[model samples]
Target: MATTPSSAMRSLDRAFDVLGVLEDTRQPLRLSEVARRAELHVATAQRILNVLIERGYAAKEETGYVAGPAAVATAHAFLVNNRLSQVALPVLQELAATTSLTASLYVRVGHFRVLIARVQGRNPLRYQLPIGEKLPLYLGAGKALAAWLPDAELHSLIEQSAPFTRVSGEHVTAEDLAADLDQVRKAGYALSLSERAVNVTAVSAPIRHAEDVLGALSIAGPSSELTETDHTRLIGEVCRAADAIAARCP
Candidate 1:
């Protein structure tokens, strides 16, 4: 019997799911483990894995299965082509200099936000996050970007990352996340107090093209230095920088 279009699509999805599970592990994964994680039958997962291995998207190791170099190349291509990072780095550097606090750029990837670039401030106590690090989408600057996503994409993200959890002592629930997003939409910016790390506070604003928000830019520092007054001032500066970056986009 011929496979229906929907069935074929589901098979394709299962193949990608196997690849995703392997990618997250960052190491070889057992076939049984991959089947369990992908929620597919063992035989079905085996068939998909075989296809991925044949195409060089995955390879078999002594321990299990691992993503091949082709996957890494694809990810690198994405970073090189990511428009937001290229356009926002100079602005982030300027913002860091002006605020004397670390400035960062984040974009959502899959279920997390990846820090693509950051500029450290001159202050000895300034906050710093390593580039290419993945952060939870509901915390810190990542949350700000997730909050401003379009309704459909936002809901999809929320559903994919449901049952919110605490990060660095900040309690978060889905309702709280929705409420915070509402506030961000109204204020045109977002702030977090030690949400992702202790003794750190951050202010982030959306970067838009025309009317669509594409990503977020944030400035972070030690709470002692980023006082209420400083927070207000940084918010204004970050917003202005974001606007300038947006205006320059083609």
Candidate 2:
């Protein structure tokens, strides 16, 4: 049977709705939760999720459905191959060289931030984040990008990424994470003091494209080297690099 245009449109809309819900949640969501958030029937949600899973856009887990690697790859292809990285890399390198701290580019993919590139400083004590590592959107430079998102979207993300626990074994509560995000918004930057890695300190600022905040640029180093004064200076440098990248983005 020939597919009707109206029916096809409806299916497309539901598929995108499912994707949007998954993007906001950032973690695997149960089928029931997905249906509730997408405002679709359970059967309809299952059908759409099955299609997404088949196409490698979503993965079915014990808890629920989560974004798959293909989804992240598509996002990375757009950002890494685009002109933003080209424009940002040199500036990031300069920042690292000047501050003797590691500089990196982090872009949000789904509910996580992926480090797409890094420029290492001469300082042997600096922390190193390998390219392609995914970090929670509530931490470090991830929080900077998350804070710049629309308020509703940011709130949704926080709710979805709740029970925030540090990968490094430090305990971080959702309320504390929200408070930190508030500071990031007011200060126009983000800071992490051994939140992700012990003895590492980081400061980050968002990179904007037109009206959309695309990603963040951050500098990291040993906590001992990044004293209060150095942290402030790093924030300034990161923001300047972000501005330079935004101006040259294509």
Candidate 3:
């Protein structure tokens, strides 16, 4: 039987879903776990996994399955070719070195921001995330990127992501987030203390291109260490770094 276009597209989407599930994890995942995460039936996931293994996009381990060399190679291609990563690498490195804190660059993806590049400080966080990890745009440093969005879009995102719990054990309402974003816009930067992770604090500034916001740049460190530093200096450094990156970009 001839495969219909829609059927072929479905297969492609399923393949990508399976691949995304694998890539999102740091450890190997059991077939059942992968199936569950991908929202596919066990039999269907097994068939997709088998094809992925054959194509070297995934590998079967004693415990389960993991992303393979081909998947890594693909990510490497993106890193080397992505214009934003290239443009921001030097600025992020300089920012991290100057602040002695981790510097990261994020770009919006849907209602989330994905970390695309980073430079570690003298004391890197123990729980270091991979480059492609995504976090909510209404959380922590992401507010810098979210602040410049259209009012309707900004409010909608806040509405969707509100009622969040911070590491401090306090709940954040949509009104709180709206007020925070307004401050970020007025101050031209965003600051968060233990909002994304315990003991982590971040200062972020938007990277603008002409009248549009391109993304956000941030410097993060342990709350105790970062708080000891002059807040004014840290904000100045991060905002200047963000501007440098934006200037270098197209």
Q: Which candidate ranks first by lDDT, i.e. highest?
A: 3
lDDT per residue for candidate 3 within 10-60, as digits (tens), equals 999999999988877889999999999999999999999999999999999
Cα TM-score of candidate 2: 0.69
Q: For model 1, what is the alpha-carbon lDDT of residue 84? A: 75
RMSD of candidate 2 to the truth, in angstroms, is 5.4
lDDT of 2 at 7: 93
Better of 1 and 3 by TM-score: 3
1-250: candidate 2 lDDT, tens digit per residue: 9899999999999999998788767578999999999999999999999999999999998888998778878877876676767788889889989988888898888678988878888884434555767788887789889987787888888888777677567666678767878888888888888777778888899997788887899888888766798777777888988898888877
Between which residue pairs do clashes occur in model 2? Answer: none
Off by over 4 Å in 2: 1-80, 124-128, 167-170
Q: What lDDT score is found at residue 57 in candidate 1? A: 91
Better of 1 and 2 by TM-score: 1
Reference-based lDDT, residue 67, model 2: 80
Reference-based TM-score, model 3 = 0.84
lDDT of 1: 0.80
Check candidate 1 and list the clashing pairs. Answer: none
Candidate 2 — number of clashing residue pairs?
A: 0
The 10-residue segment with the lowest total lDDT in model 2? 124-133
lDDT of each: 0.80, 0.83, 0.89
For residue 73, give model 3's deviation from the true position in Å: 0.5
